[model samples]
Target: MTKPKLSTPAPVIEKVAIANRGEVAVRIVRACQELGLTSLLLHSEADRSSLAYRLADETLCIGPAEVGASYLNIEATIQGALSGGADALHPGFGFLSENADFAEACAQAGLVFVGPSPESLRLFGDKISAKDLVEKAGGPVIPGYQGQDQSLRTLLEKVEEIGYPVMVKAAAGGGGRGLKVIHRMDQAVEAIEAAQREGLSAFGSAQVFLEKYLAEAKHIEVQIFADHLGRVQHLFERECSIQRRHQKIIEEALSPSLSPTLREEITQVAVKIAEQAGYRGAGTIEFLLAPDNQFYFLEMNTRLQVEHPVTEMVLGVDLVKAQLLTAMGRSLNWQEAFHPRGHSIECRIYAEDPYRGGMPSTGVLGFCHWPQGPGRRFEVGFEKGDEITSYYDSMLAKVIVWDENRPRAIEKMKATLRDCVIFGLRTNIPFLLAMMEHPEFLSGQMTTGFVDKYFSRPLKEPSLTRSDRQLAEAVVKTLNREGLGGPRPRGPDGEAGPVPSPWGHSWRSGL
Candidate 1:
């Protein structure tokens, strides 16, 4: 492989254009300002007044609400970058972050893409190809087929050879969009056809691959950073076993279930895979740990992950800063071997209706509130009056908590979720609350299918505990005593009628 020619490291990036919107776009902007770089934002016509657009140093309208014409349009993003005089492009997580074509386009235009090289992305973005590369690097991979013919007859033969209950996954898919579970030969044909259709529509790639499915598996991933100097380091592991329909709902660091020796073994394999791919910048190596203690390589994500904050909280490192410095050809300053000190958990709060098959919720937000206090951190995108639309992802915020142990962290998260509120749109708050209260979750007996099995019950209206109810009553009484600047007025029935308080309006309404 030919090495990239290093040009006298472009004047330390005075300005950067975030190529996506929402919470991640805001996140990149804050990171840029910390490094003394001006932040630029690219928005669609519908998001002209978004909070992120207002916070940016400058904003450019890319196109209409259709993602094809706006967020996913590589040419428009590049034009926006050049017109805004941006020296670098931060493809925040989704959309163009993992797109090799987009990354190469940025490089060819002389704009720095804040991620691994396009070659590395291409090598790992395709599941079939990535499996071969991992095996070459001495990593264990599930036995499966990577061929294209996928005819029903051929697939059945392969399934017979690999054993029953295999997973049919889109080669170019992520976020669990195009995956299906097949348990017997009779179901293989229909599963493959449906997956192919979804993959074609969603990703414009109909390629699918087969893999041996492990039941009740734990999903763990290692965070690795590689610099331009051929050095790589691992930042330990994150357990993302709590998922629903292939999407992660909660993630934690220093997996409560893994032994110390097992953790080290996984980290070493992750480092080896990174070195084999000639990887640079921040990337995640995912693995599925079976009940028997054996682990198989899942796919590699060649960009900064949404759950990266949990790792940062426990390791006391800024992964975004490291990515920026690595893009500028700087080596990591920390030691090669780092250990996590405490436990950290992150819960994703989305504007969606969990009761209605998790359909995305869209409306104008009337009130926005985030949790606070010790061990709580909220990364949000929308404020009051912001519109939640179906044009983009449903995620509105990520609430993370850190503590000295898993149980404490779990409790902190439960309280934080209760304190957060978003009015005027249906949210998954009730579902999140239920998950936190599950016995299996608290005991750390979680798996990728935990949500599917335990989340069968429909969410009911949340009830306040006795102490919370008492606090609410006291707050209501105080408000009645001080009614809107005048002496408290009694109703005809002799009861305080609809006492108003700025702080307890929603609480009193039981919303």
Candidate 2:
């Protein structure tokens, strides 16, 4: 008798080009190292002295400091990858991550784009097309007008039918780029025009559609994966309800409000959207959950997300590794729902002044230290002496923590935020800590408006005690010396200012 055994094929890529910068780029580089794949970091001149530049196997300068000239320059990015001998490219969260033409270009150039095919990218990139497919897949899409009739007259008519307080969104925009919320008929046309202008400038598409904007809804998303073998799986859900200006500031797994039935239904809907589109690779299906528990599919991000670490911490799965495996034509190890091991939370640490209306802070980090513990995972973009530039997103790092339950996780996060030290720029740490202790948040009853309703600065100024006044006087002096007491912090345009290094302070009392 004779027997034969089949050997598994290896993953697809040997070398990967990270076509972005900052924390996400560093995330990709680390994943490549773990998988034994060579990493080529395509960076801008501003990021040349950054941390990811040294960690990757190779680094190539794509263009100057401006994002349009560097990270968003498709031709230069691809050229850098090819010149560096990279066989694949991983577009981290921003920049060209969701650019369909970039995906097509990579395919034509014989390079594997780690996310999805150009078709998938194009389908989901356009809001109109995405709505059509969600309906086809039997997923609930927000009621709106997503027709191809681009005439202003036609749009105005649709807006009238859709009623007031509708959201005008760019057909091919993301990250709140081409979005406008109009609450009256008179504001509809202007809103559409503004959104179209933003769309044209940001995504190179001026097309926009009107959708009914649900007020005070919760933002939730399902982490999903699809392989080359026609199999799809979900890794539970994350509640990203805490946000400001439509951008997520905090994320957590095992949404506290969802019942068992609602969870199953929502996750299935997310899977259906992916299956109907023949989607491959890692992606997220975002939805707006109403107070009554009715969820509507918002959009699908066809790549790894900024809050992916929270999912990883709770589920004990490496999404980047799974992305690599799926890109290599392998199926998920288990084509079913993954059980979460614990509760996890992520706080986006931005270089912004929350007190001064969240103004972006750009300079050198005077001092830097992240929390370290068993369940703490930091995805940092810079080093101790790194420059926190204004050329990109204001987020500088992420602090992800895990525990056996939600309350414990929140407590750990509060302590972690208090212990960390950062200097030379204002941050949102105090704001985040306040959120952790807020009654609504602690009770797991948060909506998208939670921040504005609860965290808005108190109207009346409380009397400061003798010690309080003394401390405030000291802080003002320190801030003035550090150059943070001036007007808005200017970005790196002509002459960049020196980064101030001073002793950092929490500067806030309990709510």
Candidate 3:
């Protein structure tokens, strides 16, 4: 079938309704404003006063905090778009961006989905189907069985054929959910049954597949953009090897471990897969780079990725704008993909206690102080007085840093973390600091299991020496006297406080 042509009819996108909340919603609103599009915001009852809601050109209250009636309720969100007279709907990363039903419904309602086609979503939404496309495109596929008719007996036979220690994954699930590892052939039935049940409950798709599990593999993904005019180009790769429980913690561009030849080969394969899938807009082709340098196709994300900023910083391109232009039927302006210049690092700041198994912490944000300097980008969802609820993901902000080299980027990230402060809830700042200080992390010897192996222990409490405590007390006294209009007091050195004590500016402290 010939692909339908996307025609740019003088920028028909007049207004856009963001069908989500938090940082991603704010990011979309910023993009819409940059393109001279009127930005509309939709919020739940719980998020009536969110920062994004205040920043939008128009705001609509959709439903209650229950996502089923708010974010995930396709009919309500569509009605919101229609009521607001929005020309298009931008489904940010998490809520319903990859939902084929949601995408189709938006199209049927005469509003652009601002993402890939529903056909592409459905095709790549299923792991087995995506694997078939990858194999046809000459991309390396993990040895496994994609057959559906195979019973328990036949599944065992296939497992034996594919060798032991395989992964049983839900065909419809992503984000490390609905996956089980089977070490031997005997465990296949249990693993498959569990995966099927989870997949059905989570994604409403019971289909599952098996693949050979790599022991020591690095998670890498190529960011690709395709316009409706059949123009596709890759913006290099991001090393997401640092993960915990299959969730990324830190992401960087231009992996330190990959050679030039390996990088080119993997990027080419990513483009080939996109061509085979007839993909459009921004998408990421994920892979598992093995210890022997052989990489196998993992899956394709049919929406904007959370780690897209790292790619943008290194390549000096705005992926969000690219998505908008592609959706509007404009071909890419650049004839060639630009080489990634410098190194970029992204740290996901979550409102959770990493020391306590990363349990989600919910409360009002009393204070928030982000670091500001050159090459620092902060993508945040909440502000002071905003509540960090337990209804959604615990991510509070994304701290990204860029530098000319990887080591300098790491140092810059460390400095950024040190300057950040969040109060009223436990955060993962200290946990991220511990990871960055590790010798292995600095040496770039990280893997997917890096967090599991290195960060399993609780972070040590920061120690303060006698002089440090004295200095803290002196600063508190000074702040109380000058800032809060209290009586001035003696300094830590047992002398009257100097007009400008040369101790540098007082560091703001809260969380």
Candidate 4:
């Protein structure tokens, strides 16, 4: 299929309804403020206390705490937007960001969906269709079977043709869900069933396809933006090679591993595919770079990505603002030749136990504070007294840092993570800090398997040094006086730990 003829009329948007919640919604609200637009936050019962509510100009209750009833309910979302008198709706990253039906519904309702058209979403929303479009545009896609034959027999046959270790990927969704690797024929049927079920459950689609699994591959993606005027520009590439269970945990800009020639070729290919699909607004074209430097198109994300901040930090461009402009019918001011100014890294802060099998932990947050200063940005979604529920994603914030180059960026991230304090629960801070200092990570020699190679199992907490002890002592005293949740970290010697400032706790705190 070729790019569809673009003819959607652009409207003058004055208010944008943020159709999702959490950090991305918060970011979009700020972007709307900067662009002189009102932000209408569509939230659920679970997000009544979220900071997005305070930041947005107004709030509309969609449904209960469950995501399906609120965030993913298209009818409720459209009703809220229409009732709230919004001219446009921004779906952030997850939820209905890439739902093609939602995009079509918004257009029919006379509201601009701050994203690509329904056609673009349908073409690229499915992994199979996206691969076909990339191939039609002369982009390299990994050899695999994307035929309409989703039968168990045909899938097994395709696996046999592609050899063992083939990947079963959900054609209709992302976020690392509905993906399974079958190393042998014995695992094929089970993996396929599980992937299909998950695909249906998560994305409302049961279709799945197969792909060749590259054991040592780097997850790289290019940020592409296009206006309704047929202008396309790439903001450059981001290396999300550090991941766990196929979900990215850490991301960086200007990958240390990319050769200049290879980088240019892959990113241009990304733009090529975007034009082929008539892509607009903020979208990501993901590719997998093999060890030999041969990259293949993986899929296209038809909405804003979770790790877009790393690119913003390096390029000093607000992608959310740019997206707003494009949605408002403004042409892109993106230079044909854009140069990234600095190196940056983003560490996802999740409210989970990194030392205990990465289990999800939830409760009322205590004295939550983050580092502040130059080059340190903490994009968060919660406050001290807010409850952390299991209904949503575990990610609480992202600690992003920028510097002159990669080395300095790493060091800055280290300092920022050390200063962050989030009492009342265990977090992934220790795991992230250790991952940064890992020899492979420091040398920039990493792939998608970096986490599994070193963190196959839960890691034990590293012993705290003297400075760490002092920081912990200060945190304990502060929280104690505030009558917050969390106690002093106990030392290995049975004394109050003068140890690390936050993250691990002596016990899980309650509301």
Top TM-score model: 4
- Which predicted model would earn the best lDDT? 4
Cα lDDT tens digits for candidate 3, 1-511: 2222223343467889899998888899899999898998988998875789878899998899988789888999999998999878899886778899888888777778899989999989878888888988989988888898657777777778888778878888887767887887667889889888978866777878888887688899999888767677898999998887567889999888889999999999999999888888899999999989989999999999999999989888888888887766676586575977889999999898866778788999977899899999999888988988888778889999999999999999999999999999989988998899988789987888688687777666566567876776676576665554333345445586445333344544642
Clash pairs (backbone) in predicted model 1: none
**Tens digits of lDDT, candidate 4, 1-511:** 3331233566788999999887888899999998999999999999988889888999999999998999999999999999999989999988899999999888878888899989999898978878878889999899888888889999999999999789998889698999998999999999999999989988998899989999899999999888767578888999999999888999999899888899899889988988888778889999999998889999899889999999998887889888888887887576667889889999999999998978998998888889798999989888877888999989888899999999999999999999999998778998999899999999998999899889879988677897897887777666765554456777658776444344434433532
In model 3, where do residues sit more than 4 Å from their true spots?
A: 1-11, 149-164, 182-198, 460-511
lDDT of each: 0.84, 0.84, 0.84, 0.88
The reply for model 2, stretches above 4 Å from the true place, is: 1-12, 456-511
lDDT of 2 at 443: 91
Per-residue lDDT, model 3, residue 198, is 75
In model 2, the Cα lDDT at residue 133 comes to 92
Which pairs of residues collide in model 2?
A: 12-328
| Candidate 1 residue runs with Cα over 4 Å from true position | 1-6, 9-11, 184-187, 461-511
Residue runs of model 4 more than 4 Å from their true location after superposition: 1-10, 462-511
Write down the TM-score for model 3: 0.87
Candidates 2 and 4 compared: the better one by TM-score is 4
Clashes of each: 0, 1, 0, 3
